[model samples]
Target: MDQFLHDHPITPRTDAEKQGVVNRLKRIEGQVRGIQKMVEEDRYCVDILVQISAINAALKKVGFQVAERHVKHCVSHAVKSGEGEASIDELMEVLKRLSK
Candidate 1:
């Protein structure tokens, strides 16, 4: 077992990538606030549901982007270093949660 495998690993991301994720999350935050306002204003139920759906989809997209990065960097590194099983297991666990 690699010593690094048991320890937490840090994945370095570029400033652009960080900013992109931040931008996406900010938009989602705004969407959520809009939904709250819609509720306060007594907007149509179906319209509010539609906006909620959009926010859910947006959040899933952001999650997938992060997962892709995790697989490319963390999983690949673990595999190359002969510590793939644990990393893959961790990834699969999170994937299961994401699917739900």
Candidate 2:
């Protein structure tokens, strides 16, 4: 097995926060399964496309939530600790990728 290193958040999420994100992800998972079923049933192309668009929007919403929290907690902490430039740069790079 390969192990990958990951950074931890400066401020850990509360159980409620974790659960909220998890619930949204679970709903998205269900939506994905629904799309697969639709495909198996030969659903209309436009309807499937619409669901895909919806999934994209839902994913973006989740991403924005995580980004907002990162800015509020991580970036803010780094700024307070005099490491804002690197943090901001890292954030901007990821933001550019997200935009793409």
Candidate 3:
């Protein structure tokens, strides 16, 4: 896992791919700010909880997109290079945490 941290993606994301993720992240950031404002305004608890849930779902969606790309590119490259086991194990460990 430590080694994986130092490694770069075998196939780097294209500008479009990066922009898409960045766009989604920016939206999520806005949503977070909105939540902060809601708190300041003393919004209803249920309303705040709903927004929090939406944010969680949005984050999970982004996470899955990233994981899918990682598996398709990085894991595939590692398998071809005879480093599949370690790469897979590392991915699985993180995935387990993600699910939790």
Clashes of each: 0, 0, 0
Q: Native-vs-model 1 lDDT?
A: 0.90
**Models sorted by TM-score, best on top:** 3, 2, 1
- Give the RMSD in angstroms, all C-alphas superposed, for model 3: 1.9
- Which stretches in model 1 have alpha-carbon errors above 4 Å? 1-10
Q: What is the lDDT of residue 82 in candidate 3?
A: 85
Assess candidate 2 and give its TM-score to the true structure: 0.92
The TM-scores, one per candidate, come to: 0.90, 0.92, 0.93
C-alpha lDDT score of every prediction, in listed order: 0.90, 0.88, 0.91
Query: For model 1, how does the per-residue alpha-carbon lDDT over 41-87 read when each residue is reduced to its tens digit?
Result: 99999999999999999999999999999899889998987888988
Query: Which pairs clash in model 3?
Result: none
Please report the candidate that would top lDDT against the real structure: 3
The better candidate by TM-score, 1 or 3, is: 3
Worst 10 residues of 1 by lDDT: 1-10
Candidate with more favorable, higher TM-score: 2 or 3: 3
